[model samples]
Structures are given as structure tokens and as C-alpha cells.
Target chain A: QQQVKQSPQSLIVQKGGIPIINCAYENTAFDYFPWYQQFPGKGPALLIAIRPDVSEKKEGRFTISFNKSAKQFSLHIMDSQPGDSATYFCAANPNNTDKLIFGTGTRLQVFP
Target chain B: IAGITQAPTSQILAAGRRMTLRCTQDMRHNAMYWYRQDLGLGLRLIHYSNTAGTTGKGEVPDGYSVSRANTDDFPLTLASAVPSQTSVYFCASSDSSTGFDTQYFGPGTRLTVL
Candidate 1:
């Protein structure tokens, strides 16, 4: 099983439109959730992260909606821009483990 | 300023030969990790070190060995290369805690074995 399952493997959204990527996990012990963005020919970089204590966290145009009970979390990009177009991955880790289990990945295309 | 440096950006190795991928971090982070990326699959941890002298296995550790003799370097060695070992390898470092620290990644090394 893909510990973290991401939907809409490929997405297309117009500039200024909201682009959302969803991920569902099965491990209840996972308390840390993070999102990473990778451009072609580059390694994955950290975008944002959330702990189980908070329901949501927002930083600039990016917001993470988290549901503790459902074992789910999502990344919402407001006013999506062309520069934001890249492969996004959602990952999770247990309370004590430093290793992260990543999702397959979502290729987002923001059209102008 | 080098955050993390990986040697041999790309390499081709013949099966049964030994090869080593080198990684170094100047940040002096206490923890370092190795991960492999493959098509259709996400990053999988290979090995890690919490400090200078300690090492541990991660998600996928087979056919690989790592040594952390000093704080600046962590190298992954493939005893015998094989076609199944072809993949891009990344080195990452974190400050201390798992939840509080963000891992910084290197440019990556692409290795192909045949």
C-alpha cells in the first residue's frame, strides 16, 4: 500500500485558481505531515509541515488543511501561479521515527 | 557556501564491481540521511546517522553500507553493483529533532549499474 495516497496524479488549473491536492494515510501513529516540491533536475525541497496538534497552518499563499480524526491532510495553493507548477509530494512520519514515507507525487500545471 | 555536496554527479558501474558515493555537509548538522529515488516510487531511506560515530538503517538498507567516521562526511558503498541498484541517490541533513527540524537535501547523484 502507498502509505500516503495522493489524488489527481496530474492536475491542471488556471492562474489565480485554487489547486488542491489530497492525501490519505493509514498509519494512525504518524504525527508529522510535510509537503515537498520538486522541479525537474532538482531534489525535493521542503514547502511546509504540520503536527497533529494543529488543525491547520498557513504560510503566505500556501495552506495545509489537516484532519486528525480522518488521517488526512491536504495542500491548498491560493491564487496558483505558473511558478508554482512542479511535482508536489505529501509525506508522513511517526512520532519517534525520523524517516518519512512519501506519496507517489502530483504533477501540477498552472496555465496562464 | 556548500550546504551538502555529493561527488560523482553521474556514474556507470559494471555489475559485481564496487562503488562508493560520497556526501559531505558543511552545516555541521547532527543528523545525516541517505535516500534513493526511483521512477513511480517515492524517496526511500537507505541509511542514516544521528551523530559522528553512530549509524542506523532506514526503510531500504539492503545491498548498501554506510559509515560516519567524522561529522562532515557520510558515504554509501555498494559492495557489488547490480542493474537493480540503478537509481538517483540523495543526501540530507537535519539539525536535531525529527518533528522540529527540516531536512536539507543535496543535488543528488545518478548511478547506473549494468
Candidate 2:
């Protein structure tokens, strides 16, 4: 129940394309969902996040579409650039919990 | 300010050896976490501390231990390393005081056990 399953272990896209990454979880207690982007030799950084209270949240060119009933969420990168190429991870934190359960990760490569 | 810092960018250790990964955050966040990242496995929480002087075990805490002596430092220790323990470790911090859900991560420590 703690696992957050993510699909498309790896993805490739051309520049100016939109790349989507999906994640699902079995735990209904999770209230906070966040996506993290990690570059080579760097730590994961918060790209965008959304709560179950809202269906979607957008930040700049990154957006998080959340589905409460389906226990799923996804990250969509608009006009993806080569700089966006990195490992993306989706994480969930149960209500009032301090720890987050993260997905395995998806390696995205945006080619120019 | 250095958000979070970890020591020993990478290490190759022999099995059955003891090791400790150092973590420090200058953000003065009250909560800190330790996670291990392996290819196809993502990041797994090993331990966490909501505040100084208090700590808790996480999902993969069996082979590891953690200490939170102060707000800025949290260290993870391995009593006896094994080949399976090889992975990239990350330290993260969040400011629970303000109800901030964002976790700032460190660069990560890559450990290889043989």
C-alpha cells in the first residue's frame, strides 16, 4: 500500500514536444503528491506538486494532473527542452506524515 | 546558503565494513530524511527526523541507522555493509514549522560494496 507505481521507466521525445510521466498509488491516505526532477550529478528538485483537493496544478511549463478516485497523478512537460532531460520521480506523503514514498523513477531524454 | 550538503561523493567499500554518510543543511529545517536510490527502484526512505534530538525508522531502515543531534545535521550509519547495500544515498530536509511540503535534497552519495 505504500508503493507509488510509475510507468515508462524511460521516455524519449524531440524538442518542443510534450512528455508525460504517470504515477499511481494504492494508499488513499496520501494527501500530497509532488514531482521531482534530477539532473546528472545533482539532487532531485521540486518541479511541481498537487494535492487531492484540486484536479490539476500548473507551474510555468510543468503541470500536475491529479485523479483522486483513480489514485493516480501525472506530470506533463510542455515544450520540453534538452535541459529537461533527466530522471523524474513522483512522490506521495500520507496525511500528516513526515515521510514520502517515491516512485522508482523515469528517465526522460528530450533530444534537440 | 547551502541548502543541503553530503560528504564523500562516491565510495567503494568492502563487504562487512562499517560506513557513515554525513548530511548537513543550512536552511534550519526542522525535518530531515535519508533515502537510497537504485536504478528501477527509485528512492526508498531509510530514516527520518522530524526535529532535532528525535528520529524515526523508515521503510528500508533494517540495515541502517540515523542520528539527529542538531537541526542542521543528520547522519546515517551502516553497521556492516553488504553487497546489496550498494546504491546512491540522498539526504533531504523540509521545514515542518511552516507546513512546507517541499523537500530539499542533497547531491547524493554513491556507495558500492564488493
Candidate 3:
């Protein structure tokens, strides 16, 4: 119930391409979902997040699509840039909890 | 730094050796966490403290311990390191006052136990 499975262990795309990374969880108690972006040698930073209450949320060039019924969520990068090449993580947590269960991670590489 | 910071950016230790990885945050967030990132195993929480004086165990708490002396610092200690403990460790902080789930992470400490 604590696992958040992420797909496409690694992904590669050209500039301006769209890369979608998917994550699915087995626990329905998870209410908050957040996506983090990490560059090589840097800590993962909050790129964007979404709640189960919403079907989708967009920020700048990143978007999170949530499927509450399917217990899945995904991160999509629009107009991918070389700078977007990094590892992305999707995490989830139950309400009123401080611990977040993170997916293995998706390594994204965008080439120019 | 304006956010969280970790010490000894990278370290290599002999098996059974003791090691301590430091983490400090200037945000003064109410909650702090320690996680180990391993390939194919995502980030697993090792320990967490909701406040300065209280602490709790997470998914993989064995072989590791943590202390939150004050809101600004949370350190993770390895009593006796093992080869399996080799991985990247991250320290994160979040404000518990709000229901938001945002956790600010530190640069991370890369530990390799041989």
C-alpha cells in the first residue's frame, strides 16, 4: 500500500517534444501527490503537484494529470528543453501525514 | 543558503564504520525528514521529526537514527555502515502549519560503504 510505481525507467526526447512520465499507487488513502525535478548532483525540487480532488493541474511548462479512480497520476513536460533533462520523482502521502512515499524515479533526457 | 543544506556532500566509509550526515534548514519549518535514494527503490524515508524535540521512524528506519536538536538542524547517523547502506541521502523540511505537502530538499550526501 505504500508503493508508488513509476514507469519508463528512462526516457529520451528531442527539444520541443513532449515527454510523459507515469506513476500509480496502490493506496487509496493517498490524498496529496507531488512531482519533483532533480538535476544531476542536486536535490530534487518541487516542480509541481496536484491533489486527488483535481483531475489536472498545470504550472508553467509542466502538468500533472491525476486519475483518482485508477489510482494513477502522471507528469507531462510541454516543449521539452535540454535543461529539462533530469530525474523526476512522483510522490504521495496520506492526509495529515508527513511521510511521503516516492516512486523509483524517471530519468528524462531532452536533447537539442 | 535560503533553504536546506547537507554536509559532507559525498563520503566513502569502510564497512562497520560510524558516520554522520548533517542537514540544516534555514526555513525553520516545523517538520523535517531523512530519506535514502537507491536505484530501483525510489526515496525511502528513514526517519522524521515533526518538531525539534520529537521524532518518528519511517519505512526503512533500521540501521539509521536521527536527531532534530532545533528547527534548523536534523542529522542522520549510521551506527555501523554496511555495503547495502550505500546510496544518496536527502534531507527535507516542510511547514506543518499549512496542509500543503511541499517539502524542500537539500543537495544530498552521497554515501558509499565498502
Candidate 4:
């Protein structure tokens, strides 16, 4: 079974727009949530991360809104630009283990 | 610094052939991992090593094997190739001493089996 689930396999947005990618998980034991960005032919890189203790965290134009009770989390990109186009993946890791369970991923394309 | 390096940017192999995918890290991380990325399936862990000389199976370990003889190298081997094994493989490492440490990934090696 897929421990983490992501929606909208692909997304398209215009410059200056806001793009949102959402993910849900079934394991409440997961305490760490992180997002990764990957360009074509490259490995995924960490963008931002959040712990369940906080409801939201922001860094630059990226923001992670997490809802512990809902077992859901989302990534919001403000002032989206063409440079932001890439595949985004959400991952959850249990507190007891270092292993990470990743979501299917969302391919975002920001048009100029 | 070279966080991690994977050998053979891409490879094409025939079924039943044996192959080895190499991975090396320069950060002296305590943990290393092997993952395969497929379309729509995201990235799944194939194997992992908590420290030198200790390895464990991850979500998918069938037909794949790994060994960590030192802190810098963790190589994955395929005894026999199969078409279904075609995917982009990545190697990652982290400092396990730090709780919830971020994983750094390699450029990845794309393997195609026929």
C-alpha cells in the first residue's frame, strides 16, 4: 500500500500565480514532512520541511501548510515563476525510523 | 564537495545479464540508501545501510543486493537483469547522528533492460 498519496499528477500555472500541491498520509506516527524538487535527469533535492508540531512553515516563496488532525499537508508556491517548473514530491518519515515514504509526485509547469 | 556520485549515467542491458550500479559519497555520512524512481510510482527504497558493514532491506529488495564496505561506498548489484527493473536509480546519504537529518541524493543512474 502507498503510505503517502499525492494529488494532481501534473499542474500548470502562469507566472505570478500561486501553485499548490497537496499530499495525505495514513500513518500518524509520521512526524517529519518534507518536500523535494527534481529537474529532468537529476535527483530530487530537499526544498522545505516541517514537523507536525507546527501548523505551517515558510521559506522564501515556498510555504508548507500542515494539518496534524487531518493527516494532510500541502505546498504552496507564491509568485510562481517559470524557473519553478519541476517535479515535486512529498515525503513522510516516522519518528522511530530514518526511512522516508514518498508520495507519487506532482509535475508542475509554470508558463511564462 | 561531491555530495554523492553514481557511476554510468545510464545503461542498457539484456535480460539475464549481471550488472552493478556504483555509488559513492564524500560527506562521510553514516547512512546510505538506494532508491529506484519510476513513472507514477515515485521513489522507492531498495536497500539501506545504517553504518559501515551493516545493511538492511527496504521496501523493494527483490533481485537487488547491496553492500557497504566503507563509509563512502555503497554499491547495488543485480544478479540477473529483467525488463521490469528498468528505472532511474538514485543513491542518497545522511548523517544519522542528527535526528531527522535531510538526505542528499546523487545524480542518478538510468538503467534499461531488454
Best by TM-score: 4
Per-residue lDDT of candidate 3, residues A40-60 (tens digit): 999999899888889999999
What is the C-alpha DockQ of each candidate? 0.67, 0.86, 0.85, 0.88
Off by over 4 Å in 1: B97-99
- Compared with the true structure, what per-residue lDDT tens digits does model 1 show for residues B73-106? 9999999998999999999988875344778889
Docking class of 2: high
> Model 3 chain B: which ten-residue window has the lowest total lDDT?
B96-105
lDDT of 3 by residue, B1-114 (tens): 569889999999999999999999998799999999998788899999999999999999999998877889999999999999999999999998777558999999999999
- Report chain B TM per candidate: 0.96, 0.97, 0.96, 0.98
Where model 3 places Cα greater than 4 Å from the true spot, the runs are: none
For DockQ, the strongest prediction is 4
Which CAPRI tier for candidate 3? high
- The sequence of per-residue lDDT tens digits that candidate 2 reaches over residues B1-114 is 878999989999999999999999999999999999988899999999999999998888998999999999999999999999999999999987867569999999999999
TM-score of each: 0.94, 0.97, 0.96, 0.99
RMSD vs true structure, all candidates: 1.6, 1.1, 1.2, 0.6
Ten residues in a row with the worst lDDT in model 4 chain A? A25-34
Query: Candidate 3's chain A scores what TM-score?
Result: 0.96
Against the unseen true structure, what C-alpha lDDT does each candidate score? Answer: 0.90, 0.92, 0.92, 0.96
- Interface root-mean-square deviation, each candidate: 1.3, 0.9, 0.8, 0.6
> With candidate 4 superimposed using the best TM-score fit, by how many Å does residue B36's alpha carbon deviate from the native?
0.4
True contacts kept of each: 0.51, 0.90, 0.85, 0.79
